[model samples]
Target: MNNTSVEKNLANKTVFPILFAISFSHLLNDTIQSLIPAIYPVIKHTFSLSFSQIGLITLVFQLSSSLLQPFVGLYTDKKPQPYSLALGMSFTLTGLVLLSLSANYHMMLLSVALVGLGSSIFHPEASRIAHSASGGKRGLAQSIFQLGGNAGSSLGPLLAAWIIVPYGQFSVIWFSTIALLAIIILTFVGNWYKGMVGVIKKNSHSITAISPFSKRKVVFSVSILLVLIFSKYFYMASLTSYFTFYMIDKFHVSVQSSQFYLFVFLFSVAAGTLIGGPVGDRFGRKYVIWFSILGTAPFALLLPHANLFWTTVLIVPIGVILASAFSAILVYAQELIPGKVGLVAGLFFGFAFGMGGIGSAIMGKLADETSISHVFFLCSFLPLIGLLTGLLPNIEGDRKKIKSNK
Candidate 1:
């Protein structure tokens, strides 16, 4: 019943089945979400949309995705919602159906917004579940969970190329099947989450804990993490929202070919995602964060100047290095504010989305004003902001040492 015993119990209670279930659901959820961006070229051509309009569509989707996550996480921290995951997927299903039927740009926005809302609902609670099942391997758990999303993201363009590009917009309804399967899977996850809540309630007395750092230190650390998120996601916004267009514009590649190229980058991201968490768990998150964020700089700086062959080669390392930071960053923030896992996840995730949205909107306008090539050249410097990593406190290293001593 004591704190030590409770800690041991929680540490030893990592439930891999639940972890895998939640991670699978994450994959399904993100795969559905990525479909929006995947079909952008089709939508642009069909609707005669400007680059600005394209950006606005992303703005709407990203805003809807980002704005509500913190509130959802904060609310659920107080009142856990086991079945919210399934309910969220229903929104995505509806969105996918609506996207297929949409006749106008406005309707497209509405459909994407619905999908974004589903994501807002899904992430916080699912993240909490991952944290609970971490079994003292929080970074690895987060990495597993995130690997699903990155993989899902990689799948989106391939699926779009195969399904939407050739068959046209209405074919999108086929993807609703993905959402349906996610709903069924999430229902099971919800049941497990509900049971976990009951167990937590039974052991509530032994679960009390406090942040190891002072509030000011925690706040400072969280700020630094947010900056890192800003750097990572903003740069990501450029790649995710415009990389295809860049490829097409610069190299005159076919849309399908661009999608394939994008897939290469995103697949690299998935591969890199698997590395950060376990590495952070073993070596310390601060080091992982420093290396992951700053390490991408050389490749990013070189990307805008590279030819088609070299561009293809460079993006792989760029994706791999840059993609590793999020899991480490998220887990570090969670550690800084120990008991507020849901809140930390929501804040960081939401901010990342918000930055991506904002960055997309701005870059869209920039591309409109100048060119996609110029936009990439400008964003090449964003990774240099990773120098701020020097300011982050070294809590993870200290914790690892303590654990080793114990």
Candidate 2:
């Protein structure tokens, strides 16, 4: 079959369901990860943890995820996406379960580590499968997949709050129960892969020859995308860790009000996710990415100045839209290295994102020193570096150029 026919068949047969499965798994994974910070304050108080000790929780989580991701990526290259994905989800479910049952901070930390390791496995494998199914439309595919996670992260805090508000400390257990149930359902009812036979077979022999070090374009693209995505991850972690507290402490918003504003941010993310995928597919991925980054800076600066509920409401959407920028960058990374989709996905979204959490750990320390308000403004502008990198050139899917030298 011709490339166009193959592309069409892949899209029609495989794309949406796999993306949904990947998204669903990611949604559950990210929800728990996002809730960690919110849970931290309570846990710290309960356990009498020092500031450094509390920060170590994130440090350990990110370190474990980052360390394991490249290896996961290597394994994903050789394995079936479903196997890796299922294993990752299993790890996540197991970790959350352990966390639910934990009475001490050490056990809680171990649970977080388990969740991080599971995430390291899931992201690259699922993303590679999605990218292969997408033909060359990596950005749109990733955007759709990541939109699910953004929605999950956005929803998790509010959900945790709602449950915890009524049940207090026991709410974490309930969260784990929900994740466990979802895993069980997904395991049996999952239709995440429908036509993987052709797609996987076409690339079955390709992974052995794929090496990021040999491909200059892949290396350069990964480096640039890493910086771009790192900024996004740092912002996400910061928002997850600090935004609710910021609203409560700095703006004097009540906990309920703070949670409500978080929901506003999430709503905007959902809107951005819906908008980003189609827009990236149509008008070009670069514009969507640059737009999200350049656009978000002004909103970041405006956030500290906003006093009223309405003002906060407006800025939340800006943050949400900006969060969706990952869709463009991630897609770009995958397309830049076609055959090594798993490696690229793992490096960009998994390892790089974990590194971003490390950056957020530093940001958290900075928040302790200066104000998060001031630090966040600077973080907002960091995406500009990414915007500039996107302007470099279009090298994606240009195999003719790559093979021309031969």
- The local distance difference test score of each candidate is 0.89, 0.66
Candidate 1, 274-363: lDDT as tens digits: 899999989888899999999999999999999999999999999999989999999888878766777888888989998999999999
What's the count of clashing pairs in each model shown? 0, 1
- In candidate 1, the residue pairs with backbone N, CA or C atoms under 3 Å apart (3 or more residues apart, or in different chains) clash, namely none
What lDDT tens digits, residue by residue, belong to model 2 across residues 1-406? 8975674566445356656766776777778766676565556667887545666788777766677666677676766545556667777777777876778878978988897887787677667666665655556677767777777777766876677544655667667765675566445323444346455656545444443234675566567667777766676666666676677767787665676667677667766875666677777667777777767776765766777665567656676677667777666665566556667666766656576668767877787777767766666666556556644355423444666755
State the lDDT at 58 in candidate 1: 88
Model 1 alpha-carbon drift over 4 Å, by segment: 1-11, 201-208, 397-406
On the 0 to 100 scale, the lDDT of residue 237 in model 2 is: 62
Query: After best superposition, candidate 2 residue 182: deviation in angstroms?
Result: 3.6
RMSD to truth, every model: 2.4, 3.9
Instruction: Tally clashing residue pairs in candidate 1.
Output: 0
User: Lowest summed-lDDT stretch of 10 residues in model 2?
Assistant: 185-194
